[model samples]
Target chain A: MRHTIPPRSGAAFTLERGQRLTVIDPEGEQVADLLAFSRSDIDEVISSGRSLDYASRIFLTTGDALYSNRSNVMLRIVEDTVGRHDFLLTPCSADTFRILYDDAEPHRGCFGNLAHALAPYGIGPDRIPVAFNVFMNVAVDGDTGALAVRPPLSRAGDRIVFEAETDLIIGLTACSAPQSNNFAFKPIEYEISS
Target chain B: MRHTIPPRSGAAFTLERGQRLTVIDPEGEQVADLLAFSRSDIDEVISSGRSLDYASRIFLTTGDALYSNRSNVMLRIVEDTVGRHDFLLTPCSADTFRILYDDAEPHRGCFGNLAHALAPYGIGPDRIPVAFNVFMNVAVDGDTGALAVRPPLSRAGDRIVFEAETDLIIGLTACSAPQSNNFAFKPIEYEISS
Candidate 1:
């Protein structure tokens, strides 16, 4: 699938109810990670465990509820653009990048996955960690239990929107699928409302 | 803030040249912990302390290169949404939840976070383990060395993207920031692509 990135970022948004968030993946060719938190609270929702689970992309949906340690409602997807989401899935570092691309140089361009998200509070990798990956197409091999990564199901100007009851803090990786072998470039766009 | 959610059970894809990934946060949002590995080489990635610093998110993102026990590249963020992607953070769990949350509920819901995302892999908390909440906004009180919850700076639709040069596997969580009533409910939106 061929994808054309916009001139601006992948998405643009505004915080208000009944608003919309959009992504133009012209060919289901872009994947993103979505996370949320309370507006008043000054922290993230998932510790490390749940964040990794979210990457699997199993329980993300309209009715699916993501609860924090405090048991507060994180977010509800009011609308969806392109295809469904995959809460489980993440990128790799230089080592794995070399493993895949053989000739690539080794470097830790950015090592913080999900666990790194909560380090600010001294909550090291033992607590808050990995996160969900949306819009990337991958399937588990029934027999081998292997996850297959290929193209995506989104297209140009495709968008997704959610209604955040509380303030949400999101972390997105717009273009590092091949950690060391980036080459993936696109500007995602979005709209958000309270 | 606001966010956009990918479709249900859906994903996006992007193609690249060589290995050049791009990652940018919405604005000033800080992304903390991060984990990466190979989709087909899960064991190798897990056992190796390089790509995924099990004990902490600190060394994970440092300029140091990560290698699996067998010496494979798990991940290397070509770009970073937040500057502190290499910091060491911890994963949130049920035990921690019980110790943190203000109210007393069965299971405490800390494990629930991981349970929800790990259900698909059939890897329960016992099998897979806890996770790290990557990119969560937080801070520490200088005077008391106490963990503080800062309003997550991640705006709506803020994203961090990386190239999947390797089949990466990771875990995540939303931990308890001291600033809140013990159990901080910082919601988040997450996604990824290949």
Candidate 2:
């Protein structure tokens, strides 16, 4: 089924093992933060560290597997049009705006959206780990260890497909952070296939 | 007073504002995972994203402030003998040994140690975020976005000192992972000065 997550909002749903989820940036230059948890045990959530450790690379694309904290495969990227994504960053939250941007009134951002969306599945803010930022472009300078969040290279209609290796609860957001989405927000589309 | 965190173990303590903490690599080539939480609230813990976001560099040394999830300054590096450290990786855990090393009996790594030590302060396993890895060396290839964990550059008596910016709860570990500590486990020493 096709679903639209409006700009600056999030959604949560369950995907059975072997199901494929395709997340699309309906509009170009948008970022979507994605989180996955084991349907049976919320404690076994997607782990950026384990996935990165096993993959040995930051920019994951088709053929890469997202591993859980328990080191179980959760999702495997089966298809990707935009290959650049960020797993090194925690989802932007109110603190991100208040601290980095110095905004007096900060947006709740993807972190809050995920917490609110996943609350039905017994997930809390503290349980939210670093997210797989689909379509987000983060450039790391190897020489100086500096980081820069650049505008995504994804054009309109770009999508990444992930096949579930286990039954899972998924949280996804059309990121609200200005710096992440090129100072503008746009809706995201997703479809699940058996 | 000097305190020794025996090999592969951890410790937790409270630090009043302005107190300086000196974490020493007493025997060298060891990694210490450090975590900080607000004394008033456990939810406002150290944030790697915030620290690196603000610093614009991954190699945090003297003059850098460790930030909390709530965007507050929790600790500031006042002195550093070895400038290389890692904030991009999560503390090693049982899953790390099992998945990465194929160990049949995986040791409860720094993550477990921190969780156990900080339990008295109401912190749980899920609350532990990416830690500040003291004296650890991590190499990131900018072009490929690849990461490699290398042996620490710290020699005997190398230390990194931080001054508490607020009343804080601290968790420190003499890392148990063989790779992080150069295939040898060693005790870590710490001293607090008011």
Candidate 3:
């Protein structure tokens, strides 16, 4: 079924093994932060380190399997319209606004939204790990190791599909951080199918 | 005071604000994983993304300050002998051995050791975040964004010193992963001074 997560908000749901989830950027240049946890054990949450270590690449796309903390497969990307995703960044939070943007009134970013959404599933903020930032553009300087956030390349209707490898609880957000969304927030659409 | 963390083991201690922590590679080519939590609030742990975001560089060394999740200063690097360290990767765990090394008898790596050492302080495994990996050589390919674990360059007596910016709970480990230590395990020494 199709679901829309309003701009700067998040949602959490369950997906059985073999199910598919498609996250769509309905508006151009928006980013989504995705996270997965094993349903049988929340402690076995998705791990960016394990996935990147095994994949040997930071940019994960079609055919890449996101691994759990216990080395188990949680989700495998089967389709990706925008291959440039960021695995290095933690979800932007209230601190992000306070520190990076120097905003006088900081909105709780994706991290806080996810924390609230996942709390019903008994997942706390501390349980959250680095997210698979869908369609987010980040540039890393090869020499100095400095990082810069760039505007996403995803256009309207761009989507990424993931096939669940195990029973999972997924937390997803329409990123609230201004830089990640190119300074504008938009809704994110997702569909789940068996 | 000086303390030794045996090879493949870990320790936890407290440091008052303004005190200095000097982590020493007593034996050549060893790596140490370091973590800090605010003594006043365990929820506000050290954050790799915040530190890297503010610093704009990943190879943290002398003159760098590690930031907490709340964007507060946690530890400031007052001195560093070996310039290279890893902030991108998570602490190596049992899953790392199983998935990366394919070991029949996988040893719980630094993650497990830190979890054990910090459990007494009410810090669970889930609370652990990406550690500041001292003397760990990680090469990130500028073009492909691929990462490789390389041998540390720290020789005997090499040390990195951090001045506590707040009262903190510190977890330190002599990394168990062979690749990080140049295929040899060795004890790590640390001293604290006001």
Candidate 4:
């Protein structure tokens, strides 16, 4: 299945074992929140801490497996065009808007979009976990150890591909937070296939 | 309503606004994972990051408010018997067992317990967020910046009380991981009242 998730929106789909999902930044400099759960046991969702421990690295690249909280392999990064994805920061939520921008406007965020996307499967707001902020730029200050959210470094058509290790439900949201840049949020393009 | 949660198990209940939930470590050395979701919107669950940001502190104490990812107040700490509670580390999951102990045994962890407890309400694994690791002793090493997991500093009868700011679905899990100590996991007693 293939889809173009509009800005500030999300999409959900089932990706069988051995299948692959490719997330593309069609216009470049756009951010997407990538999340997944085991089809049989949703509790065994992706855990960034486990992945970092298994890989012994802070950032992920091709050949690294995305491990679940159960230490089970969920997805393997088969390819990558951008290598600066963020796994430490949680997804941007409404609270993020209120804190960062001091605006109470009901701006669409990855948290709410993921909830709406997974609602059909009986997943609610409480179930949304921290997502892999794909194509997003976050640099840790070496001296102060502070994380700085920067603009995307990916160019047009830059994408990352992952092969599922088990039957999985995938959720992707085109982040609409203006913190990414001072401009409007852009759409995201993706494809899933066996 | 009041209940005793057995070691390696968990319990779930609904707490309405204006009500208070008090968790007590009767035997004192045991640790518990505390989680909550808004009764009206599950997505608006307790967020440790936001809570820390709101209080501008690392360890939670009395008078600190637990904030949601949306930055809304979920619960306020009305009283605390033990002032050293962890709000940073996510609950111990199966992966924690595999990494820390190399044991593939299906030992109970907070992640599975929370999922199992909330399953009756249609909340599955995907919704289980990082929890407030109440009574667990994790000290960060200043030189190495490594977190050392130690035995609980709480003595018998230690407890913490929180007043619900909104109607909430609360989950509590008794941690059974050997990381606590060589002693067997102990039971936890709690009560909810308006």
Candidate 5:
């Protein structure tokens, strides 16, 4: 009935300016896989990240902001769960795939995914040299104890919002991170704003 | 090292040919999140349905030659495995950092992790796109039991290799899809060849 995303609970929420939605994982742990782009141009990639590097953190909870490569702002974390964030483990092309299939060479893993996605826009993986990791969290273990890979503050059901800088293309997917709270992969949720 | 990806006792395997990597959800009951691309370029978005439809079911596989907006073929999926592979997902933006912490966003998630590990090459999110999920069975059941999803028959540790269609970039991430099978979010493995 509206230009919106339906919650897993079976309710639809239209994303508007200052209007937000909270997609719940229901599970104890959920990793919100978020991707934002310009409202005017859905091709621009958003710029996001975590700083304090804490654990159990959430996004859009008054901490992170979605940015663009042109240095434009997209969304901002107005709410959060867990506590910290990390924009470090984004995917790309590397030698992993090459070695697995018995090919002739190696490549980068991170840029591979992005390169295929930008085909309509006339871009290439070579043009992709940077990216961001939104709500995903990380915990780096040190000798004494595990380091707070991100800050620690976000809890479940937290929310975030971003003002699109242009028409943007978003691709969202949860993670099965081997390096998170546990090797056990969890589900997550999020919302967007004009 | 052996060109073969050792089989994990309970993992799945795929034979990737035709320049595209087909991820079979061995659980037969679970959906897989397919992530891949040609490393030669990063702006292409392989994870979207519209893009896949435009590219045909031959969605970027281990060897499906990916052509850029400039009509350039990027890297190919050299190898494949069900237990392990690099799939691109999740990341933060500049706005994400400003929202989560007092300073900047942290770099932790897959996209973040990738950018950090490959930052030396100057690869970033703006250059990438959300990856496509291949052979990943997602069952959105309707009122009809008429839709019977096929069981994904893959052997654990079985792998496929690809000859590069062009210089490529490959990103991978074992998915945690719960749609097909009870969604235990069991981990899958992948191995690349080149």
Candidate 6:
């Protein structure tokens, strides 16, 4: 399966166990919030906290496994063109705009987009979990411990591949953070294959 | 609606806008993971990060609004018998077992319980988000900023109430951490009324 997720919008698909899904940042600078859930059970979804605990690393790279909250293997990173995928930050949402920025106007964020995309599956807002920030550049200052979100380090056409360990429903949203220099966040191309 | 969530187990329900939900620690000294989502959208779910940012405080109490990731108000703390609630930690999951403890046996945790409880609603593991640890005594070292999870501080019958701002789904789990002297973790009584 292959599809294009337009800027400021999102998409969802089901990937069978043992299949591989690759998300491509065709424009390089855009961040894609990649989320996943077990197809058979929604509660057996991917958890970043569990992934960090099992992998013992914050940033994900090829060969790392994404674990579910139950400690089951969900997805394994099989390939990566950009090695700096971030699991530290939560996906951008409307609260992000109201609290972090001074903007009063309603801003469409990945949270809303993901919810809209997954609605057809009978998944609502309460079911959306934290996402993997693909191609996002987040720098943690060693001395101060302050976190900074930078522009993507990935070049155009860079992609990250994950092999599913279980039947899964995947959601992807082109992040809407204008401060990340992703003002004109571009579409993302995704392909899933066995 | 009213129900009792047994120790090591959980339950889920939907609360209409303007309704109130109260969670009671009847015997006290127990921790409950309280989570919520927008009934209309799953991606615009509750966000602890956004809640802290909007409330401008670490601890939640009366008048504090629980903000969704999209910055929308999901619930407002309207009353409380115990003032301490933790929004900093992720619920204990199976990965927490693997990383934090040396025990080889599989241990039940809030993550699994929430998943099971929400299964009938078509919610799975991936939908579970970071939760509010209610009545869990987490002491933050003033100088070092290190956190220690202690036993609950509230006495019997202590409760916290929230008025729903949106149509919402709520999940609660009696925390399964044995180290916190919650080995005999008791059931929690919850009531949702308009």
Residue A15, candidate 2: C-alpha displacement in angstroms: 2.0
- B32-92, model 4: which lDDT tens digit per residue? 8899988887767887655654454556778988887667889999999877776645666
| Candidate closer to the true structure by TM-score (higher is better), 3 or 6 | 3
The CA lDDT at A57 in model 6 is 53
True contacts kept of each: 0.05, 0.50, 0.49, 0.06, 0.02, 0.12
Question: Which residue pairs in candidate 2 collide?
Answer: none
Tens digits of per-residue lDDT for model 3, A1-194: 79999999999999999999999999889999999998888888887767887887778899999987667889999999988898888888987888788988888899999999999999998777789899998888766787888899999999999999999999999999898888999999999999
Residue B87 in model 4: shift from native, Å? 4.8
Q: Can you write out model 5's per-residue Cα lDDT over A33-126, one digit (the tens) per residue?
A: 4444444554455432122122122222454455554345555555554434444233323332332334366433224444444545554334
lDDT of each: 0.40, 0.91, 0.90, 0.78, 0.37, 0.76
Choose the strongest candidate by lDDT. Answer: 2
Better of 1 and 4 by TM-score: 4
Instruction: For each candidate, give its TM-score against the true structure.
Output: 0.42, 0.93, 0.93, 0.69, 0.35, 0.64
For B1-194, candidate 6 gives per-residue lDDT tens digits of: 56788877788889999999999887888888988877776556677656764554557788988887666889999998888777656677665776677557746588888888777766666667778878876554432333566677778899999999999888898788775435567878889888
Off by over 4 Å in 6: A104-107, A141-146, B1-46, B52-66, B69-89, B93-95, B98-128, B132-194
Candidate 3, residues B1-194, lDDT tens digits: the string is 78999999999999999999999999889999999999998988988777887786778888889998777899999999999998877788887888788888888899999999999999998777778999998888766787888999999999999999999999999999999999999999999999
Instruction: Candidate 4: count the clashes.
Output: 5
Q: TM-score winner among the candidates?
A: 3
**Per-prediction interface RMSD in Å:** 15.5, 1.9, 2.0, 5.5, 16.8, 6.6
Give the worst 10-residue stretch by lDDT in candidate 5 chain A. A5-14
DockQ of 5: 0.03
Error of 5 at A21 (Å): 5.4
List model 1 lDDT by residue over A13-52, tens digit each.
2233333333344434666654444444534453333432
Q: What is the TM-score of chain B alone in each candidate?
A: 0.55, 0.99, 0.99, 0.95, 0.44, 0.94
Cα lDDT of model 2 by residue, A18-108, tens digit: 9999999988999999999999989889887778878878889999999987778999999999889998788888888887789999989
